[model samples]
Target: MLTFYHAPNSRSTSIRQLILELGVADKVKTVEVTIPRQDGSGARDPKNPHPEGKVPYLTDGEDYVRERAAIILYLTDRFPEAGLGRPVGDAQRGRYLSWLIWYQGVLEPVTILNWAKLDHPAVKASLRDYDTALQRLDEVLGRQPYLLGDDFSAVDLLCAGPFAWFGDQMPATPAIRDWVARCMDRPAVRETAER
Candidate 1:
């Protein structure tokens, strides 16, 4: 059985939702643990196996996966029957990977900087600003219902998770906001929140 170390109200909430979406809740064992929050509210849990003591850490036998994108990839691939992931040969595979990486590499950092109200030219030149990132998402979501064309996949869940938690801070455009609403309206997401 896979062991999932999760913290309530953390990024792990998305993973829990994904597990429910995949109908694999019974296959994995979830361990609720506390993690250090940005506001300095909680302490690092000794039970969490993540080197940095982060939530959403997964241990399956000798293999372990950390980071939201990596764990999303791992779980989706592990349960491909759920059709939440684009397999290697699928045409959308490249796009799928790109969005996941972008969420972690670009969007997340931009959000942090935006929340901090730090405006640096270098950051704008490199990762760009929050508005720019939102523009990219807006463009894509405008064309289709999800990040990857019409299908609602893990990428959508991964991208929309932040907005569900921080809509007030993110200030998404109409298209992005609508897309997030569609994603969050899913029963799995609602169930995850209720948990």
Candidate 2:
């Protein structure tokens, strides 16, 4: 059985939602652990196997996976029956991987910097600004319902998660807003939230 270390209301919620979507909740063991929050309310849990003491870490036998994008990839690929991940031969595989990486590499950092009001020139030059990130999302969501064309996949879960949690901070663009709504409307997402 896979062991999932999660923290409620943190980024791990996305993983929990994915697990529910995959219908593998019974197969995996969820170990809720507290993590240091931005507001300094929680403490780092020694039980969390993540080296950084973060939530959303997964362990399977001797193997372990950390980081949201990596874990998403691992679970989706491991449980391909859910069709949340694009397999290697699928045409959208490259696009799928790109969106996953972009969420963690670019979108997240930009959102954090903008929220903290630390959008320095160097940071903007390196990671670009929040507007730029929003523009990218708007452009793609405007064309299709999901990041990878018509299919609702893990990429949508990853990309739309932040907006679902922080909708007030998200832009008023209809495309992005609607896409987020569609992503958040899923029963799995609702179940995760209720937990």
Candidate 3:
């Protein structure tokens, strides 16, 4: 049995969608770990899984996974039927992995930095480059329905979220909007979003 330490309104909903996507929704025992409660109501203890006290953590009956990208990739690997990882050595596989990592390396911080209203010269200086990142994403999305091209994969879920889930999320993101809608339409996504 796998225990997924998750919370509502937090990043864990994405993980929940993944469980549904994998078709192993029942195999995954979801533990709703609400945050900021301080009543010990969630996966708040870093020592339990993420060491950083994150919302989404998974224990595959043995090991604990904290990061969203890591969890997505791992689930796809463990359950090949999920089709989220795609085939090995495939060019799209590389692209899939790239987008998955992009969330952490680019999307996460970039979205937060822009949303938080940081005005420090140093902070403000490089922040402008987020447009370039957004541009790159837009260019890629313009070419395909999914980030990896025609196929929907785990990486897609990792990119669209709390930060970029609005009208102004991207200045002109029609393609990105379409892709997000495609992903959200997945039965798994709908189920998880409702949670």
Q: Which stretches of candidate 3 lie over 4 Å from their true place?
A: 37-49, 119-128, 163-170
lDDT of 1 by residue, 1-195 (tens): 999999989999989999999999999999999999989999998888899988889999999999999999999989999999998899989999999999999998999899999999999999999999988998898889998888799999999988889877778888988899899889998887788
Ranking by TM-score: 1, 2, 3
Instruction: Please give the CA lDDT of all the candidate structures.
Output: 0.91, 0.92, 0.74
Better of 1 and 3 by TM-score: 1
In candidate 3, position 170 carries an lDDT of 51
lDDT of 2 by residue, 1-195 (tens): 899999999999999999999999998999999999989899999899899999899999999999999999999999999999998899999999999999999999988888878858888888888999989999898989999989899999999988999988756488998999999999998888787
Model 1: colliding residue pairs: none
Please list the Cα RMSD from the true structure of every candidate, rounded to 1 decimal place: 1.0, 1.1, 3.4
Model 1's alpha-carbon lDDT is 0.91
Against the hidden reference, what TM-scores do the models get?
Answer: 0.96, 0.96, 0.83
Clashes of each: 0, 0, 1
Residue-wise lDDT of candidate 3 within 1-195, one digit each (tens)? 888888776778888888888899878888775465545555455444556667788997677787888888888887887688866766577777778887876677666776665545675354444666678778988998877778888888778664335546555578877777777778886777676
Report residue 70 deviation for candidate 2 (angstroms): 0.1
Is 2 or 3 the stronger prediction by TM-score?
2
What lDDT would candidate 3 get against the real structure? 0.74
